[model samples]
Target: MPDPILPLQADQIGKTYRQGATTIHALRHVSLTVEQGEFVAVMGASGSGKSTLLHAIAGLIDVDAGRVVIAGQDLSLLTDRALTKFRRSRLGIVFQSHNLLPSLSAEDNIRLPAESTENLDQEIDDLLDRLRLSARRNHKPAALSGGEQQRVAIARALICNPAILLADEPTGSLDSVTGAEVCRHLRELVDDQQRSIVMVTHEPHVAMWADRVVVLKDGNNLAEFVTDGRRDPQSLAKEYHQTLEGEVVR
Candidate 1:
C-alpha cells in the first residue's frame, strides 16, 4: 500500500495576545490534521478560536507553542522569505469579503495569482467556465452579485493549483439560497480537482458539505462527526445542532 499523504497538519498549537496585563489566549493547544483530498470543516461559535486556528495553521500569525507542516514542509524551519514563497505556491485562501479588485474583470481576478508563475497562462476563461462565471467574465467585483464574487474568489484560489485551500466563513455574508449555491460549486471543485479544503464556519449546513467535521471550542479540538458516505446536509444539520446543544448542557 502507498503511504498516506497529508496536505496540512498542526500539533499542539497555541497562541496568546497580551493586552496590557490581561492576556487573552486565542488558541489553546489545538491540534488538527487534514489528509490529502479531504474536505474538513472546523466549526465553532464566535470567539471559539476557529479563525485563530486557521491563522495558526496558515502561518499568518506566530504561535507561542507547537508546530505546523504544509505539503510536507516544516514551517517552523523556514525563514520568512522562504515561508512566503512556500505559502504562495502551495496554500490558497478565500475570505468572506470576496477581496476582488474593483478594476479587474472576473477572468483577470482569477488569473492574478498565475502572474507569479513561470510562463504559465492557466487559461482564465476555462476556469471561469468551470465556475459558471464565463458569462460574467467581463464583470468586475462591483458588477457581480455576492455569490458570483465568491465564485470568482474560489476560481482565483484554485488557479494556483495549490496543495490545500483554506476558507474562512466563505458563506457568512451570503443569503441562504446563494450560500447553498456556493457550497455546490465548492463540492464540484474538490471532487473534480482532488483539492483538499480546511474550512472554518459556524453554519452546520456549510459544515455538512465537508467529508468530515471537526468541532472546536475554548481553543481546542473536541470531536469529529463523519458520515459513512456523503450524507444529506439537512439531516446532518439536525444532528449537528443536537450535538451542539448537548455540549452546552455539559
Candidate 2:
C-alpha cells in the first residue's frame, strides 16, 4: 500500500531565471507528492523542465514561489547552511555520469562518503556487499565496466541511507542491456528495502519500475499512470509512446 504522508511534496512550486530582459520560467506551478516507500518516475522530453523540476526538489535551486517539503520540513524555511546540511543528511541523488574519482577503487568509491564521518564504516561495508562490489573492491573506475561503474554510483547513493532517493536519467548513459539491469537493481531496492525513489527520465522502461509514473511538460504535470503496478516495464514504455503520439495529434 502507498504511504499516507508524503516523503517528498512540492506545492505549486515555481522557478524563473532572468537572462537580461527575458525571464525563463523553468517551472510553472509544479506540484507533486511522492509517498513514503513509493517508486515514482518523472517522464518528459528534452527541455520539458524535467531537470529543472529535479533541481528544485533537490534544493539545488530555490523556487521563486510555493513550497517544497522533504521528510516533513519545509525547504523554503531553511537557511542556506541548514539546507545544505539537511540535504547532506537526508537526500540521496544519482546522476547520469558515474562520477567516480579516477584514483578511487570501486570499493572506495562506494564507501567514499563515509570518510566524512567517524561512524558509518560498517554501513558502508554492508552497502558494498549489497551492490556486489566486494569482488571488484580494489578495481579502479577505469578498470570497471560501465555497469559496474553505475553500480558503484548506486552504492554511493545508498551509503548515506537517505530518506528518499532521487535519480536523474540514471540509465541514460548506458546501453539498452545495461540500462535494463540498472532498472532491475532499482526495483529490488524499492521492493526489498521499501525505499522511496523518484527518478526523472524520458524512458518508459525506466518508468515501469516505479509504482506510479508522472508525465510532465513545460514544467506542468500532464497525465499519470495510476494502475497496473504489476505490468512489465517494456509495456509501460509502449503505452507512454502511444500517449505521446495522442498528445501530438491533438
The TM-score between candidate 2 and the true structure equals 0.90
Per-candidate TM-score against the hidden true structure: 0.91, 0.90
lDDT of 2: 0.83
Model 2 Cα lDDT, one tens digit per residue, 201-230: 998767777888777877777767753675
Cα lDDT computed for each candidate against the true fold: 0.84, 0.83
lDDT by residue (tens digit), candidate 1, 1-250: 9766689889999999989999988888888888877888898889889999988778888899999988888889989998887787788999999999999998888878774655345466668888899899888899999999999999898887788999999999999899989988887777887889999999877887898888777776766787445547777776666666665332
| Candidate 1 overall lDDT versus native | 0.84
Clash count, one per candidate: 0, 0
Q: Judging by TM-score against the true structure, name the best candidate.
A: 1
